[model samples]
Target: MRITLERSNLLKSLNHVHRVVERRNTIPILSNVLLKAEGNDLEMKATDLDLEITEKTASMVEQAGATTVPAHLLYEIVRKLADGAEVSLATATDGQTISVASGKSKFSLQCLPQEDFPDLTAGSFSHAFKLKASDLKMLIDRTQFAISTEETRYYLNGIYFHAMAEGKALKLRAVATDGHRLARAEIDAPSGCENMPGVIIPRKTVGELQKLLDDPEVIVAVEVSDAKIRFTIGSVVITSKLIDGTFPDYQRVIPANNDREMRIDCADFTKAVDRVSTVSSERGRAVKLSLAEGQLTLTVNNPDSGSATDELAVGYDSEPMDIGFNAKYLLDITGQLTGDEAVFLFADAGSPTLVRDTDSENALYVLMPMRV
Candidate 1:
């Protein structure tokens, strides 16, 4: 393809698309980015087998053609060129090499035939809707940390997205858990989104799609079928295959009846947990919380080192009780609290503890306690 594009505009689109390219590819064509010049725009695409990302940038097209070139190599070459430099690309008649040039530097790189590239089967989609970028970003930010890294329980490796109807109103929910902790958040279901099937969005796609949702004005166009989901916004489109296995029934795991309740400032509780857990080594970062009428104390003890304790005034009036929890888990959940106060509902030291921000009733987290 013969086209001329400014360095800044080209680099912006390349940065977003290149992350989908794996460091090593079993097939050489998978490593190259397919560039096409058509209709006053240059389109760039790269993919691993599971996910594909494509972006377009305005460019001056001298002739209509297409070719595949090394993704990272071209990115690096254009990155080193002076700011505002014009980049010219050409494909020779021999069909063997592609040439790239800037003011004084030139590169002749190997090319792969465009026909060899794999085609994504979007397959008959039956659903489409529009979601606010801010709402979509919040759902991912609150739950992605709880995704499991364990390969054996492959179904737990992503956030579970589904729609539920409550009293004739539909709610969109995102849920994630790693056996030890769980995060759940909900928002108003977008109009016409009540019928989309439940899907487990893989961790890699969650990360790549997040980068595209930063703009406040961008409304994500979502289309889904039985096997795949497609996200289109502006000149970019991303397609991903959903996990076929069923997700666990997360509703049963969420506790509803816990008599004891404690209210404390979220920041103070997180800081105390961080300080007391310092003595704990890599194996167990456990901290015990002792609570009674209007008083809370956090303590941690390690045989190899000394112990530390801190006290805070809280809003608990239940009988005296003690519970042990992983310090890291508490910090992660507490950090999600955007308001000044947080509430914890507990059954006993052996049962799960439920937490949420007093100002926000839409999000809730559950943590499994550990024996100290």
Candidate 2:
């Protein structure tokens, strides 16, 4: 294959698909990105078995062929070349190496046969729907942080996306949890997704897809089936395999009645936890929150590091309650709250507590209380 493309154009195309290329690969083809030159354009495709990203850039094609080359190495070479320089790529005599050229620089890089690059069979994503880019991003950003990193649970490692239509409205929902915390975010479903199966999209896939959804002006076309999902935007298509484990019924973990309610300004609450947690160096980074009669105090005590206490005025008229929580967990929940106020509904120190944005009931958060 041979193509002469502007350096900026090539680099721009490479950056889009770079994230899906795995740095460590057991298979040689998986470590390389497939580059196809023909028909007035060059296509770059990369995959890590679970995810695949394909992008194209306009190029002056002189020959029609495809080859695989190291993704990062190609990116670096194009990135370091003189700005606006024209880059020419041609196959070597043996067709086993690709010759790259720019101003005052030329190199031959080892290439793998394009026949060896595995194309993930998209496998019949028969359902196609259009979703707002902003809405999809909200679904991912709000819940991705709660996805579990522990692979043993297997099921909890991705965001659960499913369809639930209630009272004349079809709701698209995303839920994620690591057993200690959980997040649920939703958006109105576009037309024709009422029968979509619930799928657990792996965390890495969610992150990589988010990058593609960053454009607010674009709308993402979502195609899904039992085994995979594809998000298409512009000329790019990102396909990811769905995690094959069954996500536990997280609905049971969501508390129905937690009555020790407290309403506090979000900034004040997060700050109090931050200050009190300063002394909790050895106590598992735990901070205790005691609420009584509109008064809230945060306290942290560590045997080797002494203690810290900070108090804030809140809206609470319930029974006295003491709850323990991990500082990191507290921060993650508080960071997602966009408003100034956060409402905490608690049953007791041992029971799960529910949090909500005072203005909207659509988004709710449940945080499991820790034992101090």
Q: Runs in model 1 with CA error above 4 Å?
A: none
Distance from true location, Cα of 269 in model 2, Å:
1.3
Task: Quote each prediction's TM-score.
Answer: 0.97, 0.97
Quote the positional error of residue 167 for candidate 2 in Å: 3.2
lDDT of 1 by residue, 310-343 (tens): 9999999998999999999999999887889999
Q: Rate the local accuracy (lDDT) of all candidates.
A: 0.89, 0.88
Alpha-carbon deviation at 140 in model 2, angstroms: 0.3
Task: Give candidate 1's error at residue 237 in angstroms.
Answer: 1.0
TM-score of 1: 0.97
- Model 2: per-residue Cα lDDT over 1-372, one tens digit each: 888989998998898888788788888889899999879989999999888999889999999899999999999988899997999999986889999999889989999999999888547986889987888988898889999999899999999999987788899899999999999988888886879999999998888878878787788899999999998888888888999989888889899977777999999899888888887875388889988897998988899879999899999999887889999899999998888899998988898889898765567788988888
Judging by TM-score against the true structure, name the best candidate. Answer: 1
